[model samples]
Target chain A: VDAGALDAARSRDASLTKPPGSLGQLEDLAIWYAGWRGERPKLEAPQILIFAGNHGVTAQGVSAFPPEVTAQMVANFNAGGAAINQLARCFGARIDVHPITLDRPTGDFTEGPAMTEAELLEALSLGWAAVDPAADLVIAGEMGIGNTTSAAALAAAMFGGNPRDWVGRGTGVDDEGLARKAAAVAAGLARHRGELLDPLEALRRLGGRELAAMAGAIAAARSHRIPVILDGFICTAAAAVLERIAPGALDHAIAGHQSEEPGHARLLGALGKRPVLTLGLRLGEGSGAAVALGVLKAAIACHSGMATFAEAGVADGPG
Target chain B: VDAGALDAARSRDASLTKPPGSLGQLEDLAIWYAGWRGERPKLEAPQILIFAGNHGVTAQGVSAFPPEVTAQMVANFNAGGAAINQLARCFGARIDVHPITLDRPTGDFTEGPAMTEAELLEALSLGWAAVDPAADLVIAGEMGIGNTTSAAALAAAMFGGNPRDWVGRGTGVDDEGLARKAAAVAAGLARHRGELLDPLEALRRLGGRELAAMAGAIAAARSHRIPVILDGFICTAAAAVLERIAPGALDHAIAGHQSEEPGHARLLGALGKRPVLTLGLRLGEGSGAAVALGVLKAAIACHSGMATFAEAGVADGPG
Candidate 1:
């Protein structure tokens, strides 16, 4: 964050026709943009990146949907026929679909490491290469069956909590499926308990390809000076890994929404991020991030377009 | 609320590519729109109506800003130089400013009724007349200096709460000013204790002309078949009075955002309304409502534009 830009944004907000701090979080959003971009931020040329990968953990019967649904949704995204595509179209953001293939399906982390270090690196590079430097804002989303289970496992491993506390129904699973998912997460944590303390090792052992790719995308976006808006639970869990591996990696990231997933709030809290929207959203095709772009743009418009008290000849409140 | 449209909306949501109830509150918003309009809702023509009035409550030294700021802001709104104007522009909504004048600034509510019954009716009619028949969605906002004091008094009078619990700083008031505002609310409630049980009487005695007009506009919008979006605390306070005066008047309304005012949550709760956005906003003048128009439109666009499961060849989830 740039101190000068933040100071300038605060000064601008105070001069707006409304009372100081009257705009509330909207004012803070503008200041965040200024600090992130080191200038008055414009939300032009925003892009959405959806990373898809098959989760080997799906073999554990953790999700209601089949693993093939990940590929099907990726194709759905490519055909402009998914929720993310529609949201991007509505919000005027370009959409990119990146499909990451591991050496094979991750080795079912309940029994062994989800992916080898080489495979995780390959997935990360794929996510990194997906970033478009010219974009002003980048939103990272994910599509993977059983990814929520993977996310929960990763969150538990990173934060050291009980698996049941972090597990939630993925794709509207039944009670039996939720129990299986929780059990799988606990098994995965136990299998990799030694390596789980290290964030990168946790990604290799307990995280899916898509989660790794999203963390890489976050790092790539930050390096490219493009602020990233993290999608729902799965995307945020990926960010949690990034933050652990690299301190302050999430400084350029914003939590788009509080997901309906039970662990999302705990994950976001650990990341020190406040979601821009909280509509109980849990769909993870970057839909939450895409919808939040409307708010970010409105905040930017107000920050840039609103007339000052002096300009409007409106009397200021008592100092 | 129309039962048939709501049923249709639910069916439509299920047919969409996403899982049932995947879009979270957005699904409810679409259903609300359908029920409000008695058909599929189209957000093509949205209009924001800002009702500004002066409050005699300012005479009690209950506000941070002077009473004239209300008129100044009305002028600012008219000049397209206010936050509401900028927001309306951002969301592509037509903005109308209606300034209401009382015979005097309704006698200080602490001393006497804010307005005579006849005057209150006239103000309501002014608000009613401001609603544009062509608008598909109507957002009602209020601008009145010291109005928060009036709002708190009205809320306490109708809901039987302590004035201290309802009163808050109107626009960055200091500790002394907050104390004064609470004292004024308590005084106003005492003066109107007998008549306050009747919601209409509460408005006449403790509400401002702007609030009366807002309630009128809400009733008018419902009759005209235009869905209404209620702004922050003051606006919701007006709707509370409307809901009490005419049962189901708020059936057509959506709470736009939770205001920072402490009394706002209780007021909306009393009306059985949940605000769509919660950004700690208290700028009023329908700014929160205008910003929310962006989210509403995106939801509408998604509801109307997204391809269905059959159309997109996406398999439905297991029931």
Candidate 2:
């Protein structure tokens, strides 16, 4: 973090017409932007990159939707017809859909590793290459039918938590499907217990192609000095992996919302990030992150637009 | 609430590309608008009315800022120099500054009633008249020094909570000022215990002129069929009063954010309203509500703009 920029933002916040710290987290948000940009924060040309892939875990019938739905949703996103599309339109954000592969799905983690080491590296490269240099802010979203099971498996293995504790009904699955999902996660963790010791190997073993891509995108965004906004559970799981692989990579990222998914809160807590919005969102087409763009815009606008106490001739409170 | 419009909205939400409850509170917010408008919700010509007044309780040193700061901030708001002004500009909402009385602060409620019954009624009328008929949405904000003490007093009297439990550091007051504020609240509650049984009497006794005006504006907006977005702690206190005096008056209103003020959550809870934003905001003057306008807009847009599964040729999940 840029200490000088953060100090400058704090000084500016104190000079604002309202009481110091009265804006609460907004003041911190503005300061965070300053620290990220190392100057006055400006939000312009924000981009939403949706990474879509198929999860082989769906063969276990753990998800409410079939794996084909992933491709269909990606098409919907490209056609400007999905939730993320509407949110992007509302926020004036540009959206990009990148399908890792249409024909091939990752191997079922319960049976074996989700992806070969080379495939994982290629997906990561694809993610790294997807960043738009002109973009001021980047939001990473994911689409995969059984991605939640893979995410749960990754989180369970990485965090060493019970699979049942991390597993949740993805896409409003029935109780039977939820049970199957949790069981699949437990099996995957047991099968990859030794491989999970290494974060990269764990990701290759349990994480999906979209997860790898998102993790790469996040690390790339940080390297490019562009802030990243993470979507819900699946996206945060990817972020957790990135954090383990690259310590402090999340300094450029923020969680968008607390999803209805059970593991989202734990993942965000592990990342040391607090979501700006909490509306029980569970859809994972980058909708939550896209929706949060409004708050970010408002915070930036207030930070840059409001007059100082001296400028407004308003009396400052006596602390 | 318009049941017909709400039903239509629910039907529309069901047809959207995502699951029925995937959008969570956003889906409910869109339905709220439909009910408010009795048709498709349109958020055009939004107006933010800021009611500024002074509290004689400031003489007791319950606030970090002096009473004069209220009028000064009002002038700053008129000059487009305050946080609310910046927020309004960002959200494309019109702002109106209404200064109740610069010279005459409300009576110290610890000693007596803040206003006479007639004065309270007049202040409410002023608030009601402040709403523009052309406004599609109304937001009420308050600017009053030491008003949190007054609000805490009202809430304590109405809800039977301990004064210390409801009092918090207003405007970043130190420990000493918080203690003084709490003591003053307890005293005011003790003095007006009998009068508090009647909600109107409670407002006249413990509420500031800005609070009365806000309550009036909220009631008037509902009457005018313009949904109201309430600001932080002080603003929601007025809504609580409105709810007591006129049952279901708050059905047309939604909380903007959960303020850092300790009593805000309790006040919002009493009204059965969940704030959309939780930025720890304690600043009054409708800053929270103005910032939240962006989210409301996005929710409305997504509710109306997203293509249904049928339209997008996307398959729905099997539950």
Candidate 3:
């Protein structure tokens, strides 16, 4: 972050026609964006990256949808027929689909590692290289059958909690399916116990390819000075690995919304992120973040476009 | 609201590509919009009306800014130089400014009734006539210095509460200013003791022209079948008059954001409204609601634009 730009933006925010700090969190958001971009920044291009990969845990009956739904959703995304596509178009964000070999599902973590070292590295690189260098803002989303179960297992491994605490009904599963999700998470934890100490190893053992890709995309956004908006539980869990490995790794990112998922609020608390919206959004594929982009745009628009009290001939002093 | 349109929209939402209830509150927002508009709704024209008035209570030192700032800011809004203008321009909303006799300040409620019946009726008619009947959505904002003090008093009169419970720092008031606000609210409550039972009487006795105008505009929106996004503290307090007079009078409206004003949360609880955004916005120019318009747009877009499962050739059954 540019300290000088941040200071400059703060000074400018106070001079706007409204009272100082009346805009609340928007003042901080605009200043933060100014720190990354220039003092008078504009959000011209925001990119939405949706990474899709099948999770082998679907075999464990951890999700309500079948594994092939991942590929079908990916095709739907490519054809501009998905929820994320509608959100992206609504917000004028460029949508990109990155499928990390959807035909080849990750290895079942309960039986073994979710991904081999080479496979994890390849997925990460794919995510890193997919980011648009000129984009001013980025949002990484995921589409994977049974991925929420994988996210719960990975979060429990990294953050340390009971499997049931992290598990949620993905795609509207029944009670029996929820129990299977918890059991699979517990088994994955037991299988990858020692390896969980290292965040990267834990991610490789329990997180899916799309999850790894989201982590990579978030890191890549930081390098490009593009502010990132973290989506729901699966996306946040993916990015959590980076924060665990290095403190302040996600300083460039903010949680987009607190989803209806049980573990999302806890994960956001651990990350020390206050979500921009709390609309009870639970769908993945970056829909929440895409929706939140409008807020960031409004913040920037007001910060940059509104005239100062001096310019507007408006009084700005206490009575 | 059209019941048939709402039911049809709900069924259509279930058949969308995403899982049921995955979009959370967004699904409900879209359905509500459809109920007001039709089975397929489009938010092409969102109208924002900003009513500005002066208050005699400024003599009591209840607010941080002077009364002249209201007219000055109203001019700024007219010149398209204020925060609300920026937001309206960003979201494609038509901005209308209604200065309800800004030259004549309302009588101080601490001494006597804020307005006579004729004055109250004139303000209400101005607000009622200001709303464009063709607008699909409407937002009412205000620019009245010392109006928060009036809001607190009116809220206390409508909903039983101590003066201190409803008072907050309006536009960054000092501790001394806050004390004056509470005292003013207490004085007004005592002065308007017996005649506060009727909601309209309470509004006339304690509320300013801008507040009464907001109430009128909200009531007018309901008659026109236009959905409304209620703004922050002062706006909500203004609209509460209608809701108090007739239960469910605010069914056409949803809170746009929870303001930083201390009384807003308590008022929202009484009204049974959950704000769409909780960004701590305390700016009363309908800026929060203008920003939330994007979220509403996204909800309607996803609800009306996404391909259904069978339409998109995607399987949709429990595993």
Which candidate has the highest lDDT of all?
3
Question: Which regions of candidate 1 deviate over 4 angstroms?
Answer: A102-104, B38-40, B102-104
Model 2 bad stretches (over 4 Å) = none
TM-score of chain A, all candidates? 0.96, 0.97, 0.99
Candidate DockQ values, in order, are 0.59, 0.66, 0.79
Error of 1 at A108 (Å): 1.9
Q: Give the alpha carbon lDDT tens digit for every residue of A187-221 in model 1.
A: 88777767778888898898888888998888999
Inter-residue clash pairs, candidate 1: none
Interface RMSD of 2: 2.1
Best by TM-score: 3
For model 1, what is the alpha-carbon lDDT of residue B248? 81
The CA lDDT at A204 in model 1 is 89
lDDT of 2 by residue, B111-177 (tens): 9999998889989999999999889899999888899999899888777878888899988788999
Each model's lDDT: 0.84, 0.86, 0.92
Ranking by lDDT: 3, 2, 1
Q: List the residue pairs that clash in candidate 2.
A: none
For candidate 3 chain B, the 10 contiguous residues with the lowest summed lDDT are B310-319
lDDT of 1: 0.84
Candidate 3: deviation at residue B201, Å?
1.4
Estimate, for each residue in A167-265, the C-alpha lDDT of model 3 and write its tens digit: 998789999989999999999999887889998998899999999999999999999999999999999999999999999999999888999999999
Judge candidate 2 at residue A240 and give its lDDT.
Answer: 89
